[model samples]
Target: MKVLVLGSGAGGGCPQWNCNCAMCAAARNGSRLIRARTQSSIAVSPDGQRWVLLNASPDIGQQLRLQPALQPQHGLRDTPIKAVVLMDAQVDHATGLLSLREGPPIELYVTPCVFEDLTTGLPILSVLEHYCGVRWHMLPVAGEQRVAEFVIDGFETLRFRAIAIPGKAPPYSPHRHDPKVGDNIALEITDRRSGKRLCYAPGLAAVGPSEFEWMQGADCLLVDGTFWTDDEMITAGLGSKRAADMGHLPQCSSDGRPGMMDALDGTRAGRKLLIHINNSNPILDDDGPERAELAHRGIEVAHDGMEISL
Candidate 1:
């Protein structure tokens, strides 16, 4: 399995245009400790030739421009990415599909719940139908597929399953607060030839038994690192919601409560990394205590253009 961190920042990306937050300030000043980043997204390939994006961010155009291997080739209009697999219907995750509308028809793997949200509330899909058409592959919950397993084209070397996770859908969706089985998911992708597993859940609220089981012994575990503390934004004067309220499990402990680090004690993943980092998170500062703690624990912070192979 070949993995590439296409963009490592959360929704607005590091150094958001309208903010002058500490980290954003540093990023804008070209501080090495606070490198700029785009919205969160990743690409994976069983073989280097054909790639599939885990999620398409609004920065898709710039993200692709930065990675040569993902650029178009072979024809006048072409792209190395063959498809996109969405984890949820959040604005940051699904809006990038518009940037891809100029090329060939898009092939997507998504839950019917998310598909409906895009078709109605967001209308991204309904709009795309008039552009380069979309091929929707129903990404079923594990064990729900007719063949006992779902497969996407160009990904035969891998076995992947979407595990229903307890999370809120985007505010634009009718099921935003109601929560449904397919509103959100975490993916477990395994490379058949190498027996390596990758468990990805960038938008996480709380840890569940099933989520821990999926992370157990994974070769690469890329989980959420959106906020440093549950009240990060509140304290930073950025927002009023706690991390959990926004569907992200903060990395830091507060009020003597265990954090994501404590929750991951037994997983023992070969390599544990953090993804979808928010610009407000102090962990982005390489010299900060938060970052040092993660390093001491052997956990890496994903960065744009970072590559990992297993």
Candidate 2:
């Protein structure tokens, strides 16, 4: 399986537009030690010609503009991308639908809940039909499907399941009680010919038993590394929210403690990498102590344009 792990940055992207932190400063000044990235997404291809984009980020147009081979040859009505799988309804992950408005009718896959969110006010299909043609396919949260030569499975996520976090209300809540909606999900892409697997969970609140088996067995694992510590934002003066409050797993530190590194232990999985990095995390700089710690653990920090084969 030839997989392209696209932009690994968190929602706002590394080197956030308004921040002036050291990492952002270094990245802006052309220091290779510090990296810049786009939003999280991926692409997979069997013959290297046909490709399916995982999520259409707001930066899709620019991402494709940078990579000509992945450029769509057809207008809004015709595209090279066979389909698009949406992990959630977050603007960062789904707003890029506008870019594909002119391309060929896209085969979009998403959980029924996410589809409801997309169709809440204006059905995506109707909107797309107004702009261009689009094909919709609702995927079952815990089911699998065959699209083209690839087999994909969708796993419901704990973070996006809309089970209100302790002491907080669910986002996009309803009236009396918060509406339970699955906000996040994980995708496992398998090559029918080679039987290799690549598991991707971009926004993780916490690891759960149900998905543990797949993570342990995946040939390549891309898990969330949004915040180095639960209090990272607090320490950085970025915000008062905890990692879990933002719907991401705290992998580095928690409650003034320091065992967050345990989450990325190399021995837990054969091939593991961290993505969806937040701007406050110092690991973006290669020379940082955090980077060294991850290197020691045999965990690679995902970078933009990085490619891997399973």
Candidate 3:
């Protein structure tokens, strides 16, 4: 199994154009300790030639332009991206499908609830109809006894399953507060040939007993790290909502309760990395206490262009 970190930042990316936060300012000033990142997204391949993008982030164009592996190598219209698996219908995660409109219709695996958001509220699928059409594949949640397995064209050696994580829908959807069973999900991708597994959940909210059990004994676990504290955005003056209000679990909680870090502490996965970090998160600063804490616990912060093979 081969994994590539296309973009590692949360929505709007690091040093967001309109943001002037200290971290953003430092990133704009080209601080050596701070790295500017694109929106969150990742690609995985069982054979390196055929890749499956997890989330079509808004920065898809920029990310593709810099990654030679994702670019067309045959003539001018060929792409190695064979399929896309959407975690949710958030604009930051789904809008980038437009950037891929030039290619042939690719397979898209998404939950039924997320598909509803794309068809009604956001209507991204309706927009993609005029461009390169999408072959919709129903990605089943944990208990849909019917074939929940999604198979790609040339990547049949890899097994894909969706684990319904605890999360709500995007604000733009009608199901925002009334989320169904499949509004959001985590992917457990296993390379059957090598028995290597990867659990990916960049939009993680809460971790209960079932969620924690789902993460056990994986080769790599790439989960959410959107904020450092519950009131991160509020304290940083970046937004009016707490991390919890936005369907994200911060690394640290204000009420002295267990948080993201504590949840991950129990995971027996060989490699655990953090993804979808917000611009306001102080962990972006390499010399900050937040970064030190991650280092002390041996957890890595996902970065763009990072490649891993298992």
Give lDDT tens digits, candidate 1, residues 256-308.
76777876666779999999999999999988899899998888899999999
How many pairs collide in each candidate, listed in order?
0, 9, 0
- TM-score for each prediction? 0.96, 0.83, 0.96
Q: Which ten-residue region of model 1 has the weakest summed lDDT?
A: 140-149
Q: What are the runs in model 3 whose C-alpha is more than 4 Å off?
A: 142-147
Candidate 2 clashing pairs, residues 3+ apart or interchain: 76-102, 76-103, 76-104, 77-103, 77-104, 78-104, 160-183, 160-184, 252-260
Superposed by TM-score, candidate 2 places the C-alpha of residue 203 at a distance from the truth, in angstroms, of: 0.6
TM-score (C-alpha, index-matched) for candidate 1: 0.96
Model 3, 1-310: lDDT tens digits are 9999999999999989899998999998976488989999999998888899999999999999999998898886799999999999999899999889989995899988888899999998988899999899888753453225677778989998887887879988887887677878898899999999999999988988878887888899999999999998888888899988898999985686689888888889899899999999998988888899998887889998999997
lDDT of each: 0.87, 0.67, 0.88
RMSD in angstroms, all models?
A: 2.0, 5.6, 1.7
- Model 1 global lDDT (CA atoms, 0 to 1): 0.87
* Residues 1-310, model 2: lDDT tens digits: 6667677888788788998766777789866488788887777776656677888787787777766558766555444577788766666777788888876677787766567667663255567778867677756552232111223223211111111111112244221144233445677776656667777777767654455555677678888878888888898887899887777776675665433356556235657889888887888989989889888888888987888876
Provide the lowest-lDDT 10-residue window in model 2: 156-165
